[model samples]
Target: MIRTRFAPSPNGLLHLGHAYAAIVAHDLARQHGGEFLLRIEDIDAARSRTELAEAMIEDLRWLGLHWDGPVVWQSTRLGSYGAAADRLRAMGLLYPCRCTRADIAAAATDHGPDGLIYPGTCRGRDVDPAGAAWRLDMARAVEIAGPLVWEDELAGPQHATPEIFGDIVLLRKEAPASYHLAATLDDAADGITLVTRGADLFAASHVHRLLQALLDLPVPRWHHHGLIVEGDGRKLAKRRGSPSLADMRRDGADGRALADALRHALLPAGLSLTTGIGWTT
Candidate 1:
């Protein structure tokens, strides 16, 4: 049986972008007689709000999406993430990182697909783990995992090049696990057969694919859909002041009607959809 999930962080409200993503995941599962699941990515305790998560659930419900099982929260799966991190540490695939964003920007001499690549300043440092994050030794990890590949339902076959991310963080000092580690494990734990998300995160699949190989986790096919954008082609975002589904619900909009319209590529005025990444507003 096929399984897909819509995992949203509870740090903010759900916008049209989220609705479209959810619809894609939910409809894909329903059309294939598969299961659709919901997950609250609340690992960032400082930003995660219960009231926001409650409202997020209400928004999805109002948008005519109902998952097959109870919602999963990242906060509850810390133990599993810890175990994975321990395994990587034992394999000498992880190192303590004490470099902060500012420190990295100053030391970084190269750039990668993800952004300003870390210069590996803390790679050989005897950093105190008390306040340090855990970063994957990308070179060592790739060597062990060897040449690998993954497939996307839409984009087809892809060569796994997680090195583009350049020694990404696996465990953060403030959080139990980074998105790459937590989401990958969660999908496997929940038996998600297919991962559906936005094209904006398409590059992230490479990292996730590598994590799967390193952790000996199941590799699932991915379908990276497009993002809902604005009149200026900026990807819809909460920080961009995009219209939220919650606001529409509060105004008594028809949920099912909105969903059907979304299915047909109908969007609110001054907004559009784009399969490619758009600039920030």
Candidate 2:
């Protein structure tokens, strides 16, 4: 059975872009006769709001996407992530670096596709464990692991070597679990066989795959769908508030119209979509 997940961080309101991403994941599972599961990526407690989570659930249901299993919350799984980090630490794949934002900005002299590329200034530098930031030692990781390759249904095959994201922060100085660590841990634990989300995360997939290798977990299939662009060509997100489905509801957009717009916006070229296509939201 193909198991897939829609893990959204409840940091803000669900926008049209989020709906598009959700629909793609849910519909793919239904089309494949697989299970669709929901996982709350609320590890960043400071930004994740309970109200937003409730609103997201209501929005997803309103959009007609039903998921199986009780939702998994990332905040509740710190021990698991910590254990995984510990395993990497034991293998000497992790190191303690007390680099702050200022330190990184000052040290990061090169720019890459993902913006300021880490210069690995603290790669082999020694620091006090109590005062240092915890970073994944990518140099050691590459020596232990080789190149990682994964296929995307839409974007085709993707490959990455450790040289891209050198020794990223697994745990921040404040000891909070970063997005890469939490996402990898949850995806592996949930038995997700497929992951469908927006194309913006395409580059980050490499980082996630690296984590999978480091943790010895099964890698899942990836499908990065096209993003929903706003009139200004900027990607729609909660911060932008591109008139959410709830806003549409207030304006009497109804489920059918919302579905129609989403279908027109997301369907691949040459594919025909109609109201009878069984769209839930």
What lDDT tens digits, residue by residue, belong to model 2 across residues 118-173? 77776777767886668887777876778779777766687766457777888876
- Lowest lDDT block of 10, candidate 2: 272-281
For model 2, the stretches where C-alpha displacement exceeds 4 angstroms are 266-281
* Residue 229 shift from truth in candidate 2, angstroms: 1.1
All models, RMSD in angstroms: 2.6, 5.2
lDDT to native, each model: 0.90, 0.76
| Per-model TM values vs. the true structure | 0.96, 0.88
Q: Which 10 successive residues of model 1 have the least lDDT summed?
A: 272-281
